[model samples]
Target chain A: MNLAFAEIQETIRMVQMESLDIRTVTMGINLRDCADSDFEKMNTRVFEKITSYAAKLKETAEQVEKEYGIPIINKRISITPIAEILGNATVEQAVELAKTLDRAAKELGVDFIGGYSALVHKGITKGDQTLLDALPEALSTTERVCASISVATTRTGINMDAVRQMGEIIKKASELTKDRNGIACAKLVVFCNPVEDNPFMAGAFHGSGEGEAVINVGVSGPGVVLNALKRHPDADLGQVADVIKKTAFKITRAGELLGRIVAERLEVPFGIMDLSLAPTNAMNDSVAEILEEIGLERVGTHGTIAALALMNDAVKKGGAMASSYVGGLSGAFIPVSEDNGMIRGIMDDALTLSKLEAMTCVCSVGLDMIALTGEVSAATLSAMIADEAAIGMINKKTTAVRVIPVPGKKEGEMVEFGGLLGRAPVMGVNPFSSDRFVSRGGRIPAPLQSLIN
Target chain B: MSQKRAVVSVIGKDQVGIIAKVTTILADNHINVLDISQTILQDFFTMMMLVDVSELEDLEELQTAFDKVSNELGLKINIQLEEIFQSMHRV
Candidate 1:
């Protein structure tokens, strides 16, 4: 509070200019009430609950912004899993529900809507089974519809049975809507210990225990933090970390203020401020930029793991200082299309799925925003998912896979999503096969009680 | 109304009456101290406070008020935007 040193207004201006503003303020709405045995009642009730609950989300976020002068970018809503609501309903009914939610989001003017999902982490319950079966048609037909399947867990291990099922599921999902650039699967995610209240998606869904309404804000500034680090190139690790810790603190503050404001206006409980550096297609703030600052020219390399570990730790450390509740996968995201620098790394042949997976072990979300070739087998895709789930289960972190199998395209080809669904140059897959392993069509026994160590 | 908390750190030589003088200024301005801690390393004295001033307009007001305390106590003071304070809970 030394007024003589620098004006408080100057400090505020410094924070405003240096920090990246919030990426999104998401209201996680539990749609358990949407469940109904009757198909039509289920659909109508489902539509009404989500549409009404989220209608004010974006507007309220904007209001909070103008009132506080803190910019909260996206106003999104994540609902309960679609399969849970589609009880006793046909797959067509599920697809119809998907369309209804999509229309609701469109009406609300939200950039994206999450929660067209199913979770099979422990085991695929009847509801999860139905959701799995309904995903292909539901995703193919609906534009804003996103889907997720968690067929593995730390306690229950990998569901080879569900994995085999999803292998076929993903193939059908890809083949059915190749024209939408196989965009349906792109909106889908595969997860482990998937948080119900996650504000980011195509995998966001209100957890079973979440309040009827809760607001979570995801504050991202990997690009901003990366830029700050760039300013101190030759500094030692401690100094660089000091810079990151400080940047995360300011960003989290902005997000905390926004979350409280949005939740108050929406009349929902403010959940927590997620300090995840949710990278976008923006140039300077991408995860690749952060990695580049860590001495790697690209994200896929030998030192990538160390760079990611340092970044993930520093973000959590810094963000933790700024909020009472800092949750979600609070680390760097290496999504392909959504991050322009990551996309460039892919196009330049400097990035690959293996390296992405390796980096995910040290990150919050594993192998997200990745695009695969259309020719991949459901079995191989399942194997790829199994690979990621293994990492998540072992690390006990929230990890997800959002793969876009660009329809009718081969590896090395790039497909343009047009709009925020940015373009991706299809990545090559490992030639080696996992058919025998994946086709076992049963659960892999849980890992040792003690870690592999 | 939005309220921001700051962790004010006073680091300098460990001299007599450091706490007595700093507390006087804060109390004079009616800025209630939510929490405080002190530590000594070698001849240096470090004191930190978690103070809430939703009652005040801006940090400048707090800084202007704290200058009287800092000058008399000969302490280097930093008002950290307390959201940046180390998280007490671990995940």
Candidate 2:
């Protein structure tokens, strides 16, 4: 009896040419242990603990890569919000801590350290207030440090108080380091149910219920899926979905296998797998291309959003079926520079920040990969962050920005990140200011309808 | 009679002496071809053969016999355990 096999390479079984490897396998290290009454001791603990716990991340990632042949792009550390840890310290001390955290990440070869953050969703706690106050300086001075502030939630509604204050804080953050602040705000995400085990950046922090030194892998492959779709351009939606589902299964298997090996070697519990379709700056890398191929002529058209909703939902469904513990922003990422199509489209007026915002409701992260003028003020920066957080809190999704205000550049200019580092063209900003409105510092109380309900 | 019957299929382009080359090896191993069907679908040739392997003295010897036919003819072949095939295609 003969059992025969068909040649897969021959029958157009979708060849993935430029697949995006998992960008970051971030290990979120909660730093509640850094809490101390003595300010100096607290600072030392924050630096020492984060550095010590995260020390093995790069080495572990390299070993895992060697064994599995999967390249881990970033080895990152996320911690308990620094504001909470720096409660007893002065603003200057907080900035120093920012520097120290940035230094620690650099020393460990970690790309960026997150959890320079705060949560004022309910009300501004004393520690949260301290971090908020020191944000402008803390962010301005640090090199490889990133920060986020969640000023609203569905349960708590919008914190008009924190929101207004953040307008000033963001304005200050932008003004102090106007060039980087725009880009920095993009990395810093404000969210509703900000997941703890998120292995992505600035918004990615060690939320409360996580293990000590676990490895969480965030697998991103929009480039692979997009290329697959291109091959089956004539296939019906069902056929397209089947192709995506099968492809996701194989890609996910790669991540799971690598994560298990890393966890075993490190002798720690493996964390949840993040299967977000993170894009890069490659020519074919884009969520827009998929949407464009689906129907729309360009990404930001009126029909663009509906197409995005379909693509994002389809991706989530396919990814969810493939992996058991599917968490993080497990949807399509519409980041600008990361997707070369988006970058070109935005420059040519095919996409706008407002249109990007509309699509964010259906997609995963909000206002990601956006670039603005370096001259843009922090108040506007905060206003922009607040606007995105408003979307996340209302919709109960993880929306974020990697808004880069390219230093010294005006609108229609680009800031380049060499290699997988994407380049973003600075888009025009809302000339209007919410300084007076944002100055009104009272918490935008929870939606009134919800309270009665 | 062999205790169980398994079906093996070979599909490809048929050429001169393809069946002689395949059936000769089966005969040499005493693997009596129980029933056989052959068809040409367009340019491609296909064949399904039922063999009584349960009585075969050695499964490896029968397999080696089929392997030789496969190497010479460039045929696509599938040999399936009856139960395994049934379980895969169960109602």
Candidate 3:
């Protein structure tokens, strides 16, 4: 046999017991050529383009899952930002385009379709403004469409105007879907320095720089990492880091193999593999659990940031070694709702918004999947975006805020978002107002770090 | 066509005619067994077989056949592509 018996058993154990699986195999289809002056014509082109490219996506993924005996959780499609294809189109047309995307997603049998998005990190164009205005209605009416907006980047300072508008848009989206515990807001993400080829949602989008179409895979295995750490209960921190690196290398190699096969079958170019430790609501499958295993009393305690920083760096090192192309927020994710350990930390009062914000400075994403009180003002939400954007801008990293302000829900109350989104307790925000700060709506002026060139 | 292979592993308690039952199914499907290794660890029967699946038409069909035998013998039988193990364990 080419492989050792122990290695085969270990692989089986990871799949059967440790919840190891490829998170997503997202196909990025460029819709730039789908733009047309006529509203109906553009929508028709958009629908046809997406459906034709993604017709075999789910079937191919299912075949690979069976052949390899490794589950590929989500087979999704991301396209060119709709705002780019909505040249001079009306807000109603933008909403119509979103409906076309949603209809195509349903026809293709995929769960979620991302890239109902706009990039206005520098300034909002007419088309971008149209997409922003249509977000609430677009999100409310659609089932599988996910939206993302980039309001800041390192080179371009924060667009306070877009941030404030997104705050209002999020509130309205929640109000529109208040019957479902504000579920529409869960499908939306506000990003600072968002990546173009991210295979994760609700932030995945086929960026402008990408080619016609490509396949990107996101690998997840927090449970595998946790199990590896449990074997060495008494190992020092350095040894602990080495264990995580080795485990991550194996996970990334498996992901690359699966991704390359999928891309080859689909006849699309293989883009990148995202080695993200994305956690799930399942027990022991959490980045927070990994942190706790690293000698922390809980995930959001005093030493949480240091533990996350070390783990994040080690994961990157291992993944970079395993694959030549590693991109798309390749670090540990700490979404409160999606992670059982994070939810427990929040319930136990060990984790708070402040700690999550602080931890994002050392991790991949920022302030993800947190539900806040209904009374939380839009200015406060904008202020939160500003804070997270500042962290990303200063550190030259990707940060995002996907907060749901559930209508009629108070602090300490819980909102259930069902599958994947899970449930989140409504957290209390600072009572102090950012009304004046956000009201002075202009550019925040790119920091001195932007002048590095 | 180039050669393609897979690893079929069966793990459970040692049972009568376990090897015969599995190899019969492989031979029925025209899958040639290239290598076989079997052991008993702590009163559990574990077997690993490398087979040339290049002549096999559908992997799922063979899996369903194995599923029936697996249920009859009360063993966990899984067949996976050789590439998965090679990619993870090597380099």
Superior by TM-score: candidate 1 or candidate 2: 1
Q: Model 2 misses residue A299 by how many Å?
A: 1.7
Give all TM-scores, in the order shown. Answer: 0.81, 0.76, 0.98
Candidate 1 DockQ score? 0.03
TM-score of 2: 0.76
DockQ for all models: 0.03, 0.04, 0.80
Candidate 1 TM-score, true structure as reference: 0.81
Q: How high is the TM-score of chain B in model 1? A: 0.78
In candidate 3, which residue ranges exceed 4 Å CA deviation?
Answer: A450-453
lDDT per residue (tens digit) for residues A167-212 in model 1? 7877788788777777777778888768766787777777778889
**Cα deviation in Å at residue A420, candidate 2?**
5.4
CAPRI-style grade of the A/B interface in model 2? incorrect
lDDT of 2 by residue, A1-453 (tens): 332222111111222245546678877787888788887788788778877877777888776564333467788888887776766677777778888898888889888888888887778877788888877787777767878777676677777677666656655565666544343444455565467777777678877677666678787777677776777878876777676665565556556666666667767678877777777766566777877776567778778887677667777776676567777777777777778778767877988888888888888877775767767765676677677777777676776655666667789877774444477888878899867666666666555435432
A287, model 1: CA deviation in Å?
1.2
Error of 1 at A86 (Å): 2.3
Whichever of 1 and 3 has more lDDT, that candidate is: 3
Model 3 lDDT per residue over A1-453, tens place: 768988888888899889999999999999999888888999999999999998999999899988998999999999999999899899998998899899999999998999999999999999999999999999999999999999999889899999999889998999999999888998899999999999999999999999999999999999999999999999999999999999999999999999999999999999999999999998889999999999988889999999999999999999999999999889988898999899989999999999999999999898889999989888999999999999999889999999999889999998899999999989999999999999999999888964555
Distance from true position, residue B60, model 1, in Å?
Answer: 25
